[model samples]
Target: MTLFKVAQLARTAAARGSRSYSSGMFTNAGYEASREHARGAVETWKKISLFVALPSVAIFSYVATKDELAHIHHLEHDPPKFVGYPYLHVRKRKFPYGDGEHTPFWNPLTNPDPEE
Candidate 1:
């Protein structure tokens, strides 16, 4: 039989005090109204996410990168001078692998000085 009919039978049985099949729970009286409300909420949130949240995130991302992009452009045009100090770039003992001085992953363009 249908769930509602089963519940009704369980309620009737419980009222008679034969044995309580149902634990005093029943279906929501406003289930259809609640479901419609939930559907409306979902649609509203979807619109908000697509129109408001998406654009806000994209604009924030662009704004965040704008200054960093300008700084990168400036650095590319005029890089800071490399200073030569005794402690800096020191090689008191050679590394166990790969020419002992320069690392295998070292790039000449970035770190140009590899000892004269």
Candidate 2:
């Protein structure tokens, strides 16, 4: 009925070279093997989950602002500037950074650019 019981019966059937795992369906683990398998799986999962979380959290915590999009906008486009660059002309001038503006025209003025 339980997974470990199913596994153990399958193993037994496979060892006997039987044609079906279900052929040994009545050969349940009689409680002991099922209990042992469940206990081992829970203990192993707890240890693995704890171990995996440690490195994952530590690695992500140090990620740079340069790697994220939000910080870069505050630097460049918060205040639009006027220039004779022949691009960003009059009326076309817009606050180009903070609100997810990462284009070439906006990036140069964006505060705390993510790449720097």
Candidate 3:
């Protein structure tokens, strides 16, 4: 081919490649914008769902277990009275060495103190 014709062909090819590249870049930018919008929508929906669902669950749970909750509150506030058995009597015993009148003897061989 002639040198002029080859140069012309190269110029046309370069122009076509540049146009295609610019169009592709625009398409990519459009896709990025779309994806960003989708992400924003999803995040907004998540926030809305959380706001709606948490209160709904809390209200439903409170309503469903209201009786049990009241019972628990009553139990906490007014516990049952404890009644001692007639046969189980607790006696307060005096320690032998506690008073000055009943002083301990200094016998080291036998451990006389019940605690020791």
Residues forming the 10-long window of minimal summed lDDT in candidate 2: 107-116
Off by over 4 Å in 1: 1-28, 84-116
Best by lDDT: 1
Please provide, for model 1 over 1-116, each residue's C-alpha lDDT reduced to its tens digit, 9 standing for 90 to 100: 99999999989977888554544224464666678889999999999999999999999999989987887777677765677876777778998898788778865545556353
- Ten residues in sequence with the least summed lDDT for candidate 1: 18-27
lDDT of 3 by residue, 1-116 (tens): 99999999999999998877555435878889888999999999999889998889999998979977887777667655545555532336644664533335633232222223
- Give the C-alpha lDDT of model 2: 0.61
Kindly report which residue stretches of model 3 are placed more than 4 angstroms away from their true locations once superposed: 1-26, 67-116
Residue pairs whose backbone atoms clash in candidate 3: none
TM match of model 2 to true structure:
0.34
In order, the Cα lDDT scores of the candidates are: 0.77, 0.61, 0.68
Stretches of candidate 2 above 4 Å error?
Answer: 1-29, 64-66, 69-116
Task: Tell me the number of clashing residue pairs for each predicted model.
Answer: 0, 7, 0
Comparing candidate 1 with candidate 3, which one achieves the higher lDDT? 1
Cα RMSD for predicted model 2 = 13.4
Error of 3 at 22 (Å): 17
lDDT: worst 10-residue window of model 3: 106-115
